[model samples]
Structure formats: structure tokens, C-alpha cells
Target: MSTLTHMKPRALNLLLLLSTLPVFAQKPIIGIFESTSSGAGDNQGQPGVRVLFYQSGRQWRSYNAICQDEACLKTIVHLYPPVTTWTLFKQGKPVAKVAATTPTAYHSYSEIGVQTITNPAAVLHLERRSTPDYPDRPHAILATNLSHLTDPDNWQPAAVFPLDLTHVIQAFHKLYPHPKNCTQNTTNSPSNYHDSTYPDSQIKMDSSYLSNKTNWRMLQITLGGYLCDGPPDDAYVDHWFAISPTGEVHHLGRLMHLAGAADFAREGHSELLFQVQGGNEAGYKLFYDNFTHQAQDTVTYH
Candidate 1:
């Protein structure tokens, strides 16, 4: 009756044993991938995030006909998208379920259930367990959230947290009162010169690396008009300044161009570094770099 109810007990036992092996012995695909995101950071020339994921190490592309075997195909069918809550299984039991958001972009594409990681571990136990190709040795796996994973330049560092400089701005305004000449002379009217009413909205503020140390707060300030409003002759004077915790405001220089260091954070140094432009010290320079962390100065006499 219908092939004798599927066969003899011994044959059924053999089939069950074979099916159980793949389930218990199977591994997961776990590694890091690069993702590209756009916004403020993108406008400022920094736009990349690293995506990490750990899931059943089953590959969908099957060039080999033998891989079409029922057991292997069954495992692939169960996997699904936005793999946010993926279980970390140990000894055939769920240990931990890690969750992560899937970043989306106009040009980026990600796996349905793959997670993301900012800094990946050098060696992942799950990766070593799942990858039989290097069962004894650990190797870094290369993957990406982009359709084309070969280009590193396509991915920049992840977005930074929003910078807050309210306290520093208030302190600076309090210590260094605006000049009276700014408002009295309406001919080349310096609107905000004495105006402590400087529209809090106009000034862009960010904390420099030097402030990262404990009890040491330093901030970088950029005062300028809107990009579309062209250069301000007298109504505005675009300049840069550094405010120390003690309310010591130091005028670093003026805004030169859109080109300048994104932030001192990139250098990992927590001190003021700047270059003087268009003055008696026209060709003079001062900065911190490979030579020393201490500020160094040099001048070129034309």
C-alpha cells in the first residue's frame, strides 16, 4: 500500500539519521560588510558604515547539482529578511539572539536578515565553526552591503554623533563682549559685531579632539553667512575660534575654503592646530603631525 508506507524500519532509521546530521553539523555565515549612507556627513565628505551579520552559512548559488539534495535546500528555504533577531546556537540550542538594524541607501543593498557591525572582532568563534574551508585556521571574510563589494573608497567611516556646543558658546559670549564700533558705524554695518543677540542659529559649533580628555573642554566655532548669500563684505566676517573650558577664547583664524580638516578627532590629538593665512605671517605655518604632537611653526619668505 503506497510503497508499503514508505519502506522498512531500517531504511527509515537511516534516512532520519542522515537528515539529523546536517541540522546539528551545519554552520552559519558570519562576517562584516561595508555600507554607504548619505546625509550631513555625506555632504561633508564622510559616508560609510560597516554592516555585520551572522546567520546559517548556507549559500544560495548552487553550481553543483549535488548541493540540490533535499536536506541542504530545506535549510536555505527557512532563512528570511531583516535578520534582526538571529539566534546564536550552541550545542543545538539557542544561546543568544542578536539584533541589528538594516541600513538603507539609494545605492546600497543588504541581505534580508544579515546584521551589521561597526568594529568586527579579529576572530569570531561562530565564523570558525561555520566555515569548513578553514576549519583549523581563522580568516577574514570579505563582504559588502553594496552590490559591488570590491571598492573600499565607496565606503567611508560611519556617521558621527551630533556635536553640542551650547555651553561653550554662552561662555565665549559672556567673557569677550562684542565691540561697540561694530554697531555705531552703520556705513559698513557689522550687524552682529556688538550683537550678543548673534542668532544662535547662524553659528556652527563642534567639539575638537583636544576636549576629549577628562575635565578638558574645547570647542571649535565657525561663524559665517549662508552658502547662497555670497561673501559678506562688512555685514559678516567669517572666522574660526577655539573656546577652552576656562572661557579662554582664542581666535584661530578666518574661514579659508570648504577644504579643511573635518575635525581634530581624526588625528586623535586634543590640542589646537591651525594655519595662519594672509597676514604679515602670510607664508608662516603651525601644526601638529608626524614630526610631533606639540605645535610646530615654519615660515616661507617669498
Candidate 2:
């Protein structure tokens, strides 16, 4: 092992690549993430998700350095690009691991092209487009054509949890009571991002189990609507929870926007992948081991 040294460019690159092994000796499964909507609702062949993060052993690698501005965005297309296979997971199961292909890279975000998808119900020959929301703070996408993919198996999928929003709403009011106000975000200047008038703010909740053999929930909540005012600074709100089958509730986060639940270690359970948005910094955090043992935490922002 070499002590951290100011080595030449090529030497540094070699050292970093070698660093991926040794801890687990196993290659860390590329924890790729998407926005989790397949845009299949319209059957337009339009993917709703954008490649938000490509996690390889706690690091976002190039994206962490490039997401802050546009000038670096050009480098996305210039780099040799990542050429690796990716598996699409739906509700804690592998749907398919398409053969390795470079996803079409645009300026803002990347997606698995329709060419990669076969025998679709319907396809929309969509034009090349980019959105400010994706590259919001990070003005870039992977240069490769292997788009990080997530397809909702069915348009109206069955719920994973037996409990509903009413359960959470009761918990929220009892535990964290606040002055009644329309603003869902208390950290920003333009705090209000939803259309809720006051008493009834929009409550969005997503439920999934953290294990292959459970009906519990890895619950994600957003307190307000994001459609009206574009996107706020802190979008993934802090209301993340885990509700056990017998109805015990546990708080799982301070601030995060979930990418998806995955068994990255292939250990039969799930680890949460999230885009962490806090007051001072923003990056990705992989929260694991909540069900197996005591809940532990790890953050990879570099």
C-alpha cells in the first residue's frame, strides 16, 4: 500500500482504480439511480427517470465534481465514458440487466434510449431534450449511452404497505407539531413549494419493503407540491420513515430524496439509495442495515 502522495496524473488514476478493491475484494455493484418514473404512463417510449447518480463504493466520482456548473458539463461528452452493464430493479427484484451499452448522453441528464428497450407496448420517437430540473445544481449527465434505468412494472402498481397516509399523518402531527402554515419548507426564503392553502397541505408518500420477505415500508414523504414553483432548493424533505409490519414506526432520515431501494450487497435485504440535501451540502447517502441490526449510516459526497 502506498501512502497518499502527490503523484502524476496517470499514477493517481491508477491508484484510485485499484482502491475500489481490498475492503470487500468484491467489485462494488455500480449503484446506479434514476428518478423512478418510466414515463410509461403515456406509452410514449419516453423515460421519466434521469441518471441522477452512479454510486461506486460511496463515491459519485465525476458527477460530484461536475454537477455544480455548466462548463464542466462539456467534459461529460468528452470523457471516455463509463462502459458497464446495469441491472434494473423493480420493488426489490431484478427486472433485467441489459447487455452493456452506452446510454445516449445529452447536456443535462441521460436515459436508456428506446433502442435499448425492445418490443414495447408503445414508443414515442422523442427528440433529444434536456431539463434544468435534473442538472439543477449539477449541470451534467454521463457521457455513455447506458442510461440508468427504472421502469414502473405496471402503471398502477399494488401497494407494498398495509398502512396508508393517514397512519403517517397521525404520527407526524403527534410527534412534530408545527404552526399551521402553507409553507412546507422552513429552511428557504421562498419556503412554500406546494399549492396547499394552509390546513391541508399535500402529503406524498411512497412505500416499499427493505427485505425480500416482508410487507413493511421504507417510507418516503414530501410535505408539499413541487409542481407549481418548479423545484425548491431542498426537494427530498426530511420525513423518511420505516414502519414495521406490526405497526411500529421508526425515523430513518434527517434529509434525503430516495433514488430506490436495492440489495447492492446481494445480502437478500435492501439498502436505501438517496440524494442527501442538507443545509450546508448536497450529495448521495446509502443507508443500510436497518432491518438486520441497528440502523447504521454512510455518506459519500466526494
Best candidate according to lDDT? 2
Deviating ranges (above 4 Å) for candidate 2: 1-24, 33-129, 133-157, 160-164, 179-212, 224-238, 254-257, 277-280, 291-302
Cα error of candidate 1 at position 35, Å: 33
What does candidate 1's lDDT look like per residue over 150-239, in tens digits? 211121222222332565455445543442323333443445344333555666653343433322333455544422223343223444
In terms of lDDT, the poorest run of 10 residues in model 1 is 59-68
Candidate 2 residue 266 Cα shift, in angstroms, is 2.5
RMSD of each: 23.7, 10.2
In terms of TM-score, how similar is model 1 to the real structure?
Answer: 0.26
TM-score of each: 0.26, 0.43
lDDT of 2 by residue, 1-302 (tens): 33223233443454466455464353434333232212232223332322233335543332222323333233332222234344555444454444332233323322222112232212222212446664433211111222333322111223545354567656665554442233543533445433333233565665444443565566666665433333442332547777666777776664666645554444555555665555334445555555443222222222
Q: Note the Cα lDDT for every prediction shown.
A: 0.31, 0.41
Candidate 2 lowest-lDDT run of ten: 137-146
Report the error of model 2 at residue 78, Å: 20
Instruction: List pairs with backbone clashes in candidate 2.
Output: 44-124, 67-138, 102-145, 102-146, 103-144, 103-145, 103-146, 104-145
